[model samples]
Target: MTEPQRLSRRLIEQVGCSRREAELYIEGGWVTVAGEVVDVPQFMVQDQPVALLEGAKAEAPEPVTLILHQGAQVDDRSALASITPASQAAEFDTGKRVLKGHFRRLQCLAPLQPGASGLQVFSQDWRTTRKLTVEFNKLEQEYLVEVTGTMRDGGLERLKRGITHKGVELPRVKCSWQNETHLRFALKAPEAGVFAQLCAAVGLTPLSMRRLRLGGVSMGKLPAGQWRYVTAQERF
Candidate 1:
């Protein structure tokens, strides 16, 4: 019987590839051990049939972007729980296969406010992280806010025209009633508690808030608590 050895070593011996190439194939989910895909290069194995998948490439996999529709009442940790392999939304079909390495080293962007829910973005790419963070102010976010209570005279107009806070005059935003109980707000991402404060100043109490769009991306038909990959064709 052959002694157990590192999977990368076995792949090197079997395929006659260099150490770096073996690691790339293993990390890219191209190599399988005993019919199971093993992504870790250091995985131990002995006398197991190891083979690379058909059309396997040694190139590094592209970084993935995940968009989650966080449900209301979910905390930060709980919202991230939906990122697991099984929690992927089955409705959105894509060519990208679920890989173990895809979950590592992810950076969360633009976290939702506490007790509020909507689109949550996470990415393994530095460019995406920078676009959503460093250049975040340039993007407009659309929120559907549910509120209760009557507005004071000219309160709606005040919100549309913007209000002064902490002695600073704010820029006007596109604020209008979506219906009797909901308001559509189109503006840059505001600081934490800013939305609630804005609603309060106008004699309205926010019952719930859900972001519908950020920049060019919209939370279209993404069910709450499920996540889907941002397609390559998607921008912003």
Candidate 2:
């Protein structure tokens, strides 16, 4: 049988820490094996070792990918938590957590008022959470917008040139006018929470905004309150 290794070596080998750090960590009672605490740096070990560091057991959450058909009243909070079959909607509110984690300096997109709906894409990984590709930024987001007043000349031009709301300048949006009162827009930058910002710029209160397509993937008649996974070919 192979000779059993020392506790410090076992910790360093399994936990990917420096030998000196492992010794100190083991001596300080910060190492555990098989649910039994081992505080001796020189203690002999054999077999499989489950090395642990204090407060280090929390595994990073697995990354999830999915598309969300945002409802009129839905906000970032609701979108992040709304569950689907493909993705495990995190229980923790991402908006609230991001604010606290980022020293309260994070900006949030405005929420969709009651009755507006659209597609939203999101992920939980910190590294890729803010990536536009993950949230349909690269894909064309087609919106079915209903306006109370008729779209006069320069209305489409105004949308393409971008609009300012509350003194904040919003980027120009790509759109195709469907009719006198309806238009379809494809927003390039799909930030986490910018639906309300778009509405503000358009001078419309979002009487009703429905997400028709995300990243070339359309709802295609998925009725309200239902969702489906985007297949490989479906992704644009």
Candidate 3:
């Protein structure tokens, strides 16, 4: 019999996922061999049945990521909701069975306020999830915001520094006035309700807000309430 091999490599072969993903599972103590958790990627395993804990074993469908052009009208519905048959975006019906707790229960990384529509990136792929959520600070989310009302003196500078809202002091973001009524805001770490807070902090009443770009992805020409697959060549 051959000597044991690296647990991470063995897990990669068993799960058929990316090497990084396998390493993540192993390092997170999600991989088990013979009922023992294997947290070390370098652990040796020969013929033991490599088992992945429930949450760690989930795999997204082949296509992985789905890009939805959510509309400003359906503010009640999120981009992730488009995967449902009842959703107006019927094109998302790929007929692929995404196993339990797939994209259904998964909330979108960004929550678009009702009446504001724009591009949204979501995926059943764990890699995408990790990149979007865990490493979100590295990302920049672009938005077109239309507002009514004048700015508070130094509001633009304050917004650039960061607008303290609620109890916490929010992080700084890139903001510029596009026109008398339009403004462009690029948020790096988008905390919940940040868009609205930005408008409020700037002494502007938000008339409309639409996400134009998320990292390297853009809304492009896709009509609202519709969706398209993210091609393999594209990277966020």
Q: Which tens-of-lDDT digit does each residue in 1-236 have in candidate 1? A: 98999999999999899999999999999999999999999999999999989998898888998889988887666666568888888888586778888888887787776777898888999889989888888888888899999988998789888887566666567888999999988888676777787887778899999988888888888888888999888877
Per-residue accuracy of model 2 over 1-236 as CA lDDT, tens digit each: 55798887877777788877776666554577787667567778778565776554322223333455566676767565554433423332232111111212222222233456765555443443454435634655667766554444575677788777779777677877677556676775445435456655655444556777655656665545543433335444
lDDT of each residue in 153-221, candidate 3, tens digit only: 998899888778666677788889899999999877576567777888768888888888878877776
Higher TM-score: candidate 1 or 3?
1
Provide the clash count, candidate 2. 4
Model 2 bad stretches (over 4 Å)? 1-68, 75-115, 122-140, 162-169, 190-205
Ranking by lDDT: 1, 3, 2
Clashing pairs in 1: none
Q: Residue 100 deviation, candidate 2, in Å?
A: 32
List the lowest-lDDT window of 10 residues for candidate 1: 164-173
The global Cα lDDT (0 to 1) of model 3 is 0.71
Steric overlap count per candidate: 0, 4, 0
Which model scores highest in TM-score? 1
* Structural similarity to truth (TM-score) of each candidate: 0.86, 0.44, 0.54
lDDT of each: 0.85, 0.55, 0.71
